[model samples]
Target: MSRDGTGVPHSGGAAYLGMPAFPRAAETATRDDRLRANLRHATHTIRAKRARAVAELDDWARLRQAGAAIKDRTLRHLDHHLVRLEEAVTRAGGTVHWAADAAEANRIVTDLVRATGEREVVKVKSMATQEIGLNEALAEAGIRAYETDLAELIVQLGDDLPSHILVPAIHRNRGEIRDIFRDRMASWGRPAPEGLTDRPAELAEAARRHLREKFLRAKVGLSGANFMVAETGTLVVVESEGNGRMCLTLPETLISVVGIEKTVPTWRDLEVFLQLLPRSSTAERMNPYTSMWTGTADGDGPRVFHLVLLDNGRTDTLADEVGRQALRCIRCSACLNVCPVYERAGGHAYGSPYPGPIGAILTPQLRGLASPLEESLPYASSLCGACFEVCPVAIDIPEVLVHLRERVVEGGEVTIRGTRTTIKPAKRHTAERAAMRAARWTFDHPGALRRGQWILSRSRRLRPRRLPGPGRAWTDTRELPAVPAESFRDWWARTRGGTA
Candidate 1:
């Protein structure tokens, strides 16, 4: 990890740091017709398959409600559940570590790997590790982390960022992946086969051959869990590929970095997520590989296990009543599949490991709206509510987006670095606030509103089809609504023959 001039530490190649705000990034992405095409094709296909998969379950809505309720209940007593989980893991011969932030989490993982004396560790496509930039942190510590998941491997080999949640390299076509494999696989480990083509089976075969060597040779494995059972200290990872299973079982030392919100009270709570996750994410009735481990076993799996429970702003997010609901997210990426804005803007535009509707609300809350990048995330959505409809955990993303927008437009007290401080609204939103205030005043006074409407009616012909000055951007893609010849009040009074 390296610090910028502001003394702020960044990792994972600082992929998202100093990024332009969402609107600007989105504008640039919209111009990339190729990127837009890739996103549209991929998201549409996944959403259609998911819709059919979801329709198969008659009690899906009930399951969704149950999942949401379970998450909420666990969050309500999170401290208790965490303590219980730690005790359970300890009893099961696993060491549990708590990290207050990303830096701490990275340090713990690095030290654990260093102690194992392994220079390279195989990974299980864990998002929690990505969130904290663990791969970059390990590299800084002279430890190499190899991505075993095929999409992640492609992204790593190509020197690119993940654009989608479930499928990180969603922006890349089969041809691009083949090219990446042919050119870059040798440097990483195994070389691509001679005359490699873009066929899906061929790509999978090359990735498998390349990763199999790393999996067999590595002594340490790194992972993130989809759900952690508090009662039994078992961690669960669901995946379509067998790479996760290999990472979990093949290595002698295993380390899992997981968000604190992943904890559930019992195994019964786990069953709901299992049903909802696979169908929502991969459109499968169940994942091909469902790996679970409860610490260690005698002469089986990893001999040593370390569980790093990461906070990293989750407690702060919990303080917010409206924003806390984002913690219920299961990382299914169903929202991303259904989001129209994400299809057009692409995941790179959001500038986070998480993309699409879930990212719009989750990123801002987890990091706080401290910078332009974080502040811009809340406005990334179009509020079509498709995200909420498809969410397995029933997170109301649009509601949170609107809430965060209010936070950006009218700054308020927020907890930063454990300090309570009030943040002022951004200077960019001053004109917007002024416009809203003027409209509010006009609506409050009946005579003022009547006069304003009468003036607008009389000057209807003079009104420009497009707005001028700072407002021109709003009208560039949308026509200004034409003014009517008379106000609704006039029509009502004239027809009723009373107030006139």
Candidate 2:
């Protein structure tokens, strides 16, 4: 690989650029019967497993409470804890770099890889890395970044975007995966067996065989951490597959780019999350593999370790008092599993790396509501609050969703890329906004409210079940409420005879 910092590699549309609004993206996904079946099976299976796993815990609520509190305290004293983490990492003989955003983080990692003189790096599944488009950026720099996780490997092989946070390829069934491997695996590194079947064992064997050489040959590894314990300067990654273990240990030079929000203040705080995360995410009493490392240890794992603390949009997200709670997310993706919207519309519709209920609120706030996609994201949810109930850290996703919806409709001042900018309400929503304002004005005046009700009642027969213009699209699927023949106030007046 050759590198001279002329320009950063374009991450391509791999990072959710130029995508249409949520409804449009969703419309395409919902049309695919196969995709719907895949999501339905995966989500239902996981949802049942998670509920059973969580039910086994007597102190689940307490554990959840502690997790939320710990994260809140950590975020409140985030600066202090981060400094402590850096100090601890340094004390343990590791180098730490701080990046304020994706571009800088990419540059730092690219430079670090260049310094190591390696053209290829193996990766554990890392949403943080994916969000920053690190792999594409590295590709631009002529470095090949391999995704070692099973689902991630499928996504990488198919040249597809991750459809789920926990299971990136949740949208893909086994048959599709076999086809992906049979056709695409050879091009990347290894080819599937002569007759690749979609059987679980066969698929696993194929992936294992294909990735073994890469694991042995790779000199550099890149990852994102699930939790960073400040007290011990230790980082943890929990996974079902042992691939993460290999990615963490086999490589000579390891670079971890992690969102700063993954930090916890102490070992006790870590304990609370350890209980909550596994059950919430994998629905296992404990994840099969929990890998922990402190900086670089001689003769055990990598000889060198670099931790890139990425703040991309975190500081800006943390600025909003109401929106800041999103930083509490542990990336367990419990919320995604239980989401009705995600099950139907799929993950790609929400756009960006984070999807489902989390992305609806988190992406817009993190990226800001400047674009149509971002603005449309807040409305993606039904506000059912299933996401909130399942969140291990007790984040109020629906509350944040509503808060962001207000941000979008009202067009207020918001911070983006560390600058305060006033955003205008979406032009597409102008009619809706006007209608809301007019309704509010009528409700505030008794005479007008009564007059409008009378007009509505008199014109009731002429009313259409479907609306006119843009509203017709919404009404096409949902039946507008049946208009009442008379207003409740009129009934009260007529029945009670205006006196008794």
The CA lDDT at 228 in model 2 is 93
Please give each candidate's TM-score. Answer: 0.85, 0.85
| lDDT of residue 81 for candidate 2 | 97
Model 1 pairs whose backbones collide: none
Model 2 gets an lDDT of: 0.84
Candidate No. with top lDDT: 1
RMSD for each model, in Å, please?
A: 9.4, 9.8
Clash pairs, model 2 backbone: none
> Taking the candidates one at a time, how many backbone clashes does each contain?
0, 0
